[model samples]
Target: MAETRSTTAPRVVRREPTLTGELLAEFAGTAILILFGVGVVAQVVAGQNGDDDSIHWAWGLGVTFGVYVAGRTSGAHLNPAVTVALAVFKGFAWRKVLPYSVAQLLGAFVAALIVRWVYADAIATVDPRTTFDSQGIFSTLPGAGVSIGTAFLDQVVGTALLVFLIFAVTELRATPPAANLAPFIIGLIVVAIGFAWGSNAGYAINPARDLGPRLASFLTGYSTAMREPGGQFYFWVPIVAPLIGGVLGGGLYRVLVERHLPDQTDAEQPTGRIPAEDD
Candidate 1:
């Protein structure tokens, strides 16, 4: 019998991702995120528009900066679902993935809490005669006769579209756009969803962007309109739907493009928030 040996290259030792440190980075990033979303509510409610379209513009710009800054450092996920999706696709580590998600959600919740304190008075003015359903503040509403299923469909469909768009731009684009402009591009994506589908679902694309504030609003004791007439039972769509859509989108990228990437598991050299720049 002849002895045969196989030749394979050894895996390289890379620097650890520093999950704890990433949490700190994510927390700071999420603070800015909530500040924008919650701040917009306060601004709009407090009449900061001042005869101009201040609220939407302010939020758009705010989100752009936050994503850019955090993305430059911590990958700017800020949302658990996004993190989870990336991890599932192996863009991030499985070991730190769960902790990262926990940190992201906690960060958003804490940010929401602070925003509640900051925007207390403004939220208080949303008519004490009505309950303040925080989720609806960022989305559209269903009429009295609309079924619960219909409302859920709105969230599901809107979130699916959002995840699909994000995947298209981030993964499948033939050419990666300018690094500095990626966040701006993401902001524009949200804006488009908000405008196109917003009329139906208010387009709650990001889960952290919604659940964080909703929990904070309830905990802060400023809401009077918590239970609207739209059968507000299916709030999970915003959280779950996007994740589902993101996975599908990532799979689409892998099948259509990543398979052809120089290194399917890791192609682009991540620039901290950017994907690995080292091949």
Candidate 2:
């Protein structure tokens, strides 16, 4: 018999990706994350769903819950922006980023599904009819008057400040409380950022936080609102800026300050606040 080579390409089996414990962490983190996040915005801005007055403070509690739930597992990048920054700045493994992101997005979608189910009647009753952009809806809007370049720069600088602070308080491993204190401290920082700079571009700071919710909102059937036409939405900024800021922040810390990494014992639960005084 004459030797005949097959014309078709050789079949190389692509090994299927398997779900692991890390995936669960990502899912759990993203779910509780959107719950606290969107749940807060829904309570305030959604008319019957959002009260505007009391919902704001309840928003704080939501932040606290989000961190407690997601902190240990997957470090809760709930936002894509944070995930990018984590890899670049904190030395989080690159291999994990895509999986974490997919998990985060899926988690957000599931969480949104749950919220929609809970507020089905509320969602239908609203006069104007809004898709649940609750998480990104009230939080940030794009800069109306600025040029695209300026707007982009603003997001980068603003998000960097936010992420940098995170690195300082958390990555510096300032003390035993730094890890446990993650939720409260992060929530407070967000509160301040919203008050000061959130007006333009929503102070998203974390891409996963906003983008995941935004994606869920769009997928679940909110119109062009989340899309933010003409880059007026500035979604790209939130995604890009934070990564830049996070790296800058990390670099600054490495150069300016000496690292005094906290021990494993620091993660243990404690009785009182770790003194804020810097050593």
Best by TM-score: 1
Q: All models: lDDT?
A: 0.59, 0.60
Q: Output the worst ten-in-a-row residue range by lDDT, candidate 1.
A: 270-279
Error of 2 at 81 (Å): 3.0
lDDT of 2 by residue, 104-209 (tens): 7777767766765665555555624563344344234565665656656767766667666666656434442455777787767666666666556655666666
Sliding window of 10 residues with minimal summed lDDT for model 2: 270-279
List where candidate 2 sits over 4 angstroms from the true fold.
1-19, 48-60, 127-140, 143-150, 172-178, 229-234, 258-279
- lDDT of model 1 at position 16: 55
Using alpha carbons, what is the TM-score of model 1?
A: 0.74
Q: What lDDT is reached at residue 234 by model 1?
A: 45
Q: How close is candidate 2 to the true structure, as a TM-score?
A: 0.70
> What's the TM-score of each model vs. the native?
0.74, 0.70
lDDT digits (tens) for residues 1-279 of candidate 1 = 999887878889976546566777677776676677666766565434432244445555666777776774567777666676677774576666667666666767787777666756655566443253433443234544656555556666665565555555565324455667777877776666555665444455566666666666656663422334543544465667666666665566667766775643346444223342111
lDDT for 9 (candidate 2): 86
Task: Give the RMSD in angstroms, all C-alphas superposed, for model 2.
Answer: 12.9
